[model samples]
Structures are given as structure tokens and as C-alpha cells.
Target: MTGSLETFLSTAEVHDAVFSLRPDYRAMLVVADGFDAGPSDAASEDALQAGEAAARAALRDRPVTEVPHVAAWREAYRAFGAKPQRTRNSLEAMMRRAEAGLPRINRLTDLYNAVSVLHQVPVGGEDLDRYRGAPRLVRATGEEPFDTVADGAAVVEHPEVGEVVWCDEAGVTCRRWNWRQATRTQLSEATTSALFILDALGPMSDEALDAATDDLTDRLTRLGPDVSVSSRLLAQ
Candidate 1:
């Protein structure tokens, strides 16, 4: 874990081609090690409740796409040949689901998802132990492997050419930008060290992203006294 964390510290980045497509793109990577990973408890539930309330208030009598950050992500998806209406970004999807209820997967995942909605940003939480190397945001060439489950059976899929993806040495960890995550690296109760990716566009200012990141960091830090957290913001 120490070696991988160090690799992530020096190697995570957004490729130039991705920046060429959306120069205003930004990604904040937050890594936490030695967390007390466990099931969602009172704190996480409270955060989720607050996030759901915030989403409802923000979307009052308006469509989810009208949100500034969500609108920006919509354009980004289209820029990469994906129809945002069909394949919604993580933020928009979470906003849409807020009205019903957000799933409580684990403390780590729940906390990040809550912060994501609370700040109106797209957030991805991954199990650090599952990664083979540093993570990078880039435009896929249709050759990277993306592991997922289909019909309750494990399977592999490939991204469309020019599609935006987050990958490591193993393969694509997230496909279509933030629309979906590879099952292999998803956070679970067994996860102790974790990596969180907060995706942002021009519509979402750096201050707002940092606020969200800070909220998440604070929450993670409270999980245990020995939790160690670090973060870096990548922009071009």
C-alpha cells in the first residue's frame, strides 16, 4: 500500500488529449490509508440525508440537466461521442437518484457519494488495493480492458474509441468518464486504503471542488484517529 500510494502521488494525471477536448477539466484525487472501513453507520446516513435534501432543494421545479455542473458534464460527454441523455455522468445520476434514495454501499462509498451530491460534483471511490498502478484520465483508443459484471457473471468490455476513461496499468477503472466503474476496483467493507476521484468542469469552480474534498477528508479523518489522508488537484 505504501508503494502504490507513493506511485499515485507522483503519477496520477489527466492526459493532454483529454485536456485538448475540455481545457477546463479538473480532477481532484484524494487518497486515504488506514481507514476503519465498515458498513454505513449513523454518520454516513446523516450525510446522505443531508445530501438528498440539498439535491431536492437545488432541483426544485427544474430538471437535473439545468444544474450548472451537470450541464457542463453533459457537454463533455457529447464532446467524446457519448449521449449524455442516455449515459449520465455520476453527478447527474446521483442527483436524479437523490429523490428516491442513495444506496449505502459502505462507509467510504457512502461518505464520498454524500459529499458529491452535497457539492454537486462527480465523485468516484475506488479500492486502492485493487489498482495495479497509478490512475490517469485519458481518451481511450477502444483497446483498454474494462472488467464488469453482466447477468451476474464476470465479463470484460471495451470502451468506444475516443471515449473518456480513467485507467491504471491493469485497464480502465472507469468508462465513459464517470458513468460507470469497473467492478474490480469498487470500494467495499474490506477496503482499508482508498482513492477518491472528484471530477470537475469549468462550471464547478476549484473552490467548490476543494470544499467538497475537504468535507470528505474531514469525514474520513473522523473515521479513526490514525487515518492518513492526502490530496492533489489536477488541472490544465
Candidate 2:
């Protein structure tokens, strides 16, 4: 468990944190291996565009907030003192933009966004290279540093105490559950390996999550190289 999150999932460090998740809390951790997050080719870009189009068509008449999966994430946000409307979850924000035509980033980024829209789940990824240690999810102390870029200038901020966050030895990596990711672990063209976290709540069954993980893994492996994937499901 040298570099795996499972090392601390059941350890004393996370015992109290996992206990805090209410009865309905659920999540799936998907870790990919032998990835090549380099520049996308024509086919990859085309698939990305197609996925966005499908999402827009599916959510055309309804807003993201009305979607069951997206709404569940909103509840998770409120559970930690966040205003979901003001601070939209990453999936909700991406759905909005997809409706208007999603922005194209590198292959890895596009891959998750496409899968997210295809399954209507909150899919977040991090560059394993920048991560300081195994993953940890706990209540922030409001003193841990989180690095990000503001107006193109580097900045470091701290999460409010008790706000649920994903962090490591370095500092906070994601604040307020799936709301945001730190700049330090952002996936880039050079990223070769990564971890993706899929968030879910009640009504999202284990079978559905396993299917989604398979779907994403299949697509990512097709991108290039002998990509491998390992996953875990955390539910209450």
C-alpha cells in the first residue's frame, strides 16, 4: 500500500472521517495505470465533441440541478456548509458548458468529461505525479495550504475547518468534496498515470457504479498504450 489510498482508508487517520459520512454517502475510486495523457488526435477530439453533443441533447429541456445524480452531489455540498447554487459541483458546471459546447483540453481531461456526461456522474481526476502521498479525506483544519492560480498568479489558500476535503501530506487537494481540485495535481499533457474519483449518493447502486467504471476504463484503454485500471467502491 505504498502509493495506494487503501493504505489509509481503514487506518486510524481516516476512521473518524469515514464515520462522519451519513448513511447515504457513497463513492467509487478508479485508478488508472500506463496512461498517456499526451495531446489528443483527431479521433479523440471527435469523440469528445460527440459526448458533449449527446449530453446537451439529453439535458436540453432540464437544467443540471434537476438531474438526480447532480442534485445528490449538491446535497453532499450542503452537508459541509457549501452553497451548491453559488458553488456548483464540477459535474454540474461541466454539464452547463457541454450544453453550450464543451471546451477541449488534452486527451485525459476530455476522456473523463465525456464519460461523466455519458453516465451523468461526477468524475474528478488528479495527476499522481504531483500528489505528495496517499489520498486522505477528512475535515479540514482551515490551516492546510491549497495551491491554485488566481488571475494567472500563484496563490495558496486554506479550507475552512470541518469542510470535507481530499488531501495528502502536502496540503488540501480538493476542497468541498467534488467542487474543486488543486492546481498542484491537475492533469496535464505530460501526465502518464492518474486517479479518478466518482461520487454518488443514494439511488446510485453498486451495479450502476461498476458499469460506469467499466465504461470509462474501456474508453481510456482504447486511447493508447496498455492501460490498466483498478477500482474500489465505498458505500454506506
Candidate 3:
């Protein structure tokens, strides 16, 4: 995946412009596989809290503004519940846009989420090593069967075919198409190295993509020196 940084930012700019015009607009960029969920550090927790706070603030004065992507995602998960055959929804549709055709967002997941907030777009990262094999962004084929762990204790079996998914060299790394991640490949506090990704879909401008990429790279560097980040436009 090779492209100028400017190309990425331009994509982001287009999304930003659209968001600016919406009455209630919110977006989220998330790092999926980087941090260990065992126990979030105060700082990491703080960052998550800050994001929640920002979302709340955005909705404080509005009756029907755009809702934060994360909040919407949570709702989608609840609506799906624990059915035998889970399927993809609107939120997952947006997430797949980021996972497809992007260079690995290194270090479990640092760069992806950093830019997610910057661009107001929901983004995600997953660890390829933990999976059975190399991961691919594709719609789930009913023929492929998989299991995912949620909240550490509950195991969910989803038997939907043609749902968007990240297929690792081994098997399905994440099940919710893109809405929720599997526990096996999740990043941990012990992870010091990783592949990061940032995603945006729809009609986006070059400038926004550039800015988001630059901003994410800069932030990742400050967090740790061993991180490397890159980008790719999803192939249609």
C-alpha cells in the first residue's frame, strides 16, 4: 500500500466538510488491538473518558444532532443480542471501510485511534499475530465458521455468511463484521510493537486524510519510539 500522505488527508477533509454541515454530528476513531483490556491505566481510561465526555458535550444542547459513532455501535450490539446468527449493520458498514486495504496500523493499536478522534471518524486496529493467519478484509462467507470471546467470559458463535470481516491467516479475528472485536487478537499492555490503521469512507478530501495521518503519526511517536505507521486506500 503506497500513497502520498496528502492523499489520505484529502479524504478526511471531505468527511469533515460533510460533518460540519450536519446539525448533530459525531465521529469516532478507535484503536482496537493496541492496549490490554486487562485493566486500563488511569491515562488510557482518562483518554476513553475524555472521548465519552466529548460525545456527551456534543449532544448537550441538541435534540437531534448526529450521534457519536461509538454510542451508535453500542446500541447496535445490544439490538443484535446473542443470537446464533449475527449479521452486520450500519455501524459495521462504516468500520469495514477503514479495515479494508489499509497498511497495518502498528503497535497493537496506537496510531488508528489517535487519528480517529482527530478526524472524527470511527477507526479500528487488530493484531494480526494473534490470529490463525494473515488477515484480510472481506465479507464473511457463510462457509467460514468462527467463535469470538466477548467480555472475557462469554463466547459468542456467529454463523452469518457474507458479513464484512477481518479474516486472519488463522480464522476470523473479529466477528461483528467490524462492530465488535474478538478477544483472542486484542492488544495488551505488554504489547510493545504493532501495526496501526486509520479509516474513513464516503466522499472525502485529500487534505483531511493528510492532516489525520500526520496527526496520528505525530501522536504515536510521542507515545512510544518503537512505533511505525502507514496508510492505504481501500480497493473497490
* RMSD list, candidates in order: 1.0, 2.7, 10.1
**Per-candidate TM vs. native?**
0.98, 0.89, 0.56
**What would the per-residue lDDT of candidate 3 be over residues 1-236, giving only the tens digit for each residue?**
13333333234211322233331322222222222322334444444444444444444665211444444444433432423124433233333333232223333243344345435555555543454533455555655545565577656465455444555545665554355566666665555333344434433345665676566556555564444444444322
Top TM-score: which candidate number? 1
lDDT of 1 at 180: 97
Which parts of model 3 have CA positions greater than 4 angstroms off? 1-46, 61-118, 150-156, 203-206
Better of 2 and 3 by TM-score: 2
If ranked by TM-score, best first, what sequence of candidates would result? 1, 2, 3
Error of 2 at 198 (Å): 0.7
Q: What is the lDDT of candidate 3?
A: 0.43
Best of the two (2, 3) by lDDT: 2
Q: What is the alpha-carbon lDDT of model 1 when measured against the actual structure?
A: 0.92
Q: Model 1, 41-87: lDDT tens per residue?
A: 99999999999999999999889999999999999999999999899
In order, candidate lDDTs are 0.92, 0.77, 0.43
Q: Clash pairs of candidate 1?
A: none
Q: What is the lDDT of residue 29 in candidate 1?
A: 93
As for lDDT, the candidate ahead, 1 or 2, is 1
* lDDT score for candidate 2 against the true structure: 0.77
